[model samples]
Target: MPATATRADRSPRAAEPSPRGGRMGALWRVLEGPRALDVAALLIGVCTAVLTVLGLVMVLSSSSVEAIGSTDGSYGLFRRQAMWAVGGLAALLVLRRLPLRVLKGLAWPAFGLAFLLLSLVAFTSLGHSVGGNTNWLRIGGFTMQPSEAAKLAMALWAAAVLERKGRLIRHVHHALVPVLPFGLVLVVLVLLGRDLGTAIILTGILATILFIAGTNRKVFIAFAALAATVATAMVLLAKNRLVRVQAWLFGCEGLETSGDPCFQPDHGIYALASGGWWGVGLGQSRQKWSYIPEAENDFIFTILGEELGLVGSLAVLAAFLGLAVGMYALAARTTSPFIRLTTWGIMAWLVGQAFVNIAMVTGLLPVIGVPLPFISYGGSALTLALAGVGVVLAFARHEREALRREGAPDAPTPDPSVRPQETR
Candidate 1:
């Protein structure tokens, strides 16, 4: 007591601990534990598993009638889908284990291979046409859609290039040069094969990557407008597409029921309407009995809705929403521009395609021939989609390691401007 203490000095030397601070400390401690997993990574993995399993079930149910009619028996299509599922899961496991550097190294090669495959589809005898879109390649007894592989390849290539550009991406010329030209060529290739749906999805992937890389605002808007114009022109130029658009704009009324322009849309609506709030029950969809074409492919959602009702439909949407949240969270947490852009690009591919498929089935949009990501019956689509997820999972694994090394707090903030210290 060198001097008389004031009233403030006489008060307690330590202030009471804040409840919020205590909770935050507890959370950090939990996250810092040795066995801790990244919440985002877990969420994504779980959702993917759920959707894929559900897809297999729905494929079996929806394809039974078609499979029995077209193939050896009811299980033929389901068996093929199951085999592809096995291959896809294997890919997911292998990809999730690879280092991010290895993925970056593979990007260019993937792009080149995709380009070659697409070229074969567009100009060679190997090209196989289905539903008027010659986007598939046939060899011996096997067939695959090159455009599906291109979707993943383009996303990877764009992310790798744009991330390397760094702050230079702010310049329009630097941002658009090779990326824009290469992307356009890929889209043109797909279009040459008459796959407008795949072209649209590919264009979306490019735009998403560019936006994530922080391209100039004016340039981005201009690019978007140009893309819209091209898409509209392409639609108007195709008689089939134009007819579908007309059906979407004007009701299917006054058209002959036998060869109706809105036959698919009308049947899709009927399937959904037949199922009340609870659905008709699994394996009981009358739509799959040939009322809706492509019951196991493009219009699987309608069959799902018909059998499982609105509840099942909502469940599928929730799974996709979960995927979206998880991917967004991973993208936000990573400091690597490649990881951020790739995550966003894949997100656009899967989630965007899912919504487009659902919209088409619901008649909110014209029939685009896009498959629902995990639930569709195409081997190429399922395999590539899983591979894309695998790449993102690899990024997520890297993020989890980074968090562990840094001993992340309750809310770890990453600076996007700073280059990540650990490239591997």
Candidate 2:
């Protein structure tokens, strides 16, 4: 045997792995391990899990009073919620393992498919309308919300478009010609389904993506103004929407026991008031005794307020804020503009919609009939929103891996000198 080999074999550290080999193993482990974005992704996963589980408990408590008298047993809403949870988890796991580039490749095709579905929802023969909105489709016994799919599809398309256009994206003509037209088509289609809320959410996601992608401020302002105008007009045109406007503007309708305009909102406020600081001691909401309607869906947060108290409501908001912060942190870390833009889009959609929903419940904004993201019930909406988050998480994951491969420090920062250099 070679002298060095023989010496090592007989050395005091004979059983120990070689320092070089150990280092290689350690490097390999770090290389193989999940990225920071993945870690950030996990924080979001935890937030959603906490929200979903709490939502289920709240759903059961809030819905059972109505469920027992219905066709299904007391477990009806609970069972459906449980199934949605399982399905959403499966989607998160499966999509997390998918390559970000693969989603990039499929962006346009996915958008096309989603657009087709959006168009199909208006045919009347294929779509299902409930509560005055034709936003769902009957798939066997289950219904799929096409608008939810539209939100994801629009995000992908916006990312892909920005990636392709790159630096040229700042031009007014360029931003309007294609991007504005595409979103208009989506907005029109969504409105055709009489679902202005989802359309507004989709527009919010797209606008945030564009802003992050470095579009001109003038263009963004103009686009925002246009969207606001259309949304305002749409609200005025719809009957119930006008009711919401009245409630928001004048606070005309107050609480009533039953059969009145402010029935639901009144009950919600009453429930929140009844909860006091702590709550009415969970699972014992008086307003949920058929006093509050749709407690499992739109007004679910009221149940949280009534049962979990202000502290619990604040905690829920904190979890959501943490999710927004984590996503923003991941986006701030990524150098790849596409990943950053995508994260911004997802954050705007999730956080913006959450704000709108919570605002509705607190009477800070009009009742928009928007779900509270992961905290609200409904299968199609929950799973689709989560799956979109999974895709953005993949982008964040790849960016972290890219940084690690560069052998750089964990914390990344902008170089002040680079900006002037780039402008020059």
Candidate 1: tens digits of C-alpha lDDT, residues 169-280: 9998998888989888899999998888999999999999998899999878888898889889988898778777877898667643445778778999999999888999
Alpha carbon lDDT of residue 31, candidate 2? 28
Candidate 2, residues 1-424, lDDT tens digits: the string is 2222232233232243334457646643332333435556677777877877887788788888888867788889788888887888788777777787787887889789888988888875778898789988886786788888788788788888888888888888877767778877887888898888888888888888888888889998889899989988998897678776776676655622233557788788888888878998888888887877778888889999988899989989988887886687577656666677777887888889999899888888777788988878788888877787787667766765665555456645445455334553
Backbone clash pairs for candidate 2 read none
Residue ranges of candidate 1 with Cα displaced over 4 Å: 1-37, 253-258, 408-424
Each prediction's TM-score versus the true structure: 0.87, 0.84
lDDT measured at residue 197 in model 2 versus the true structure, 0 to 100: 80
Local distance difference test values of all predictions, in order:
0.85, 0.77
lDDT of 1 at 188: 92
Worst 10 residues of 1 by lDDT: 6-15
Backbone clash tally (model 2): 0
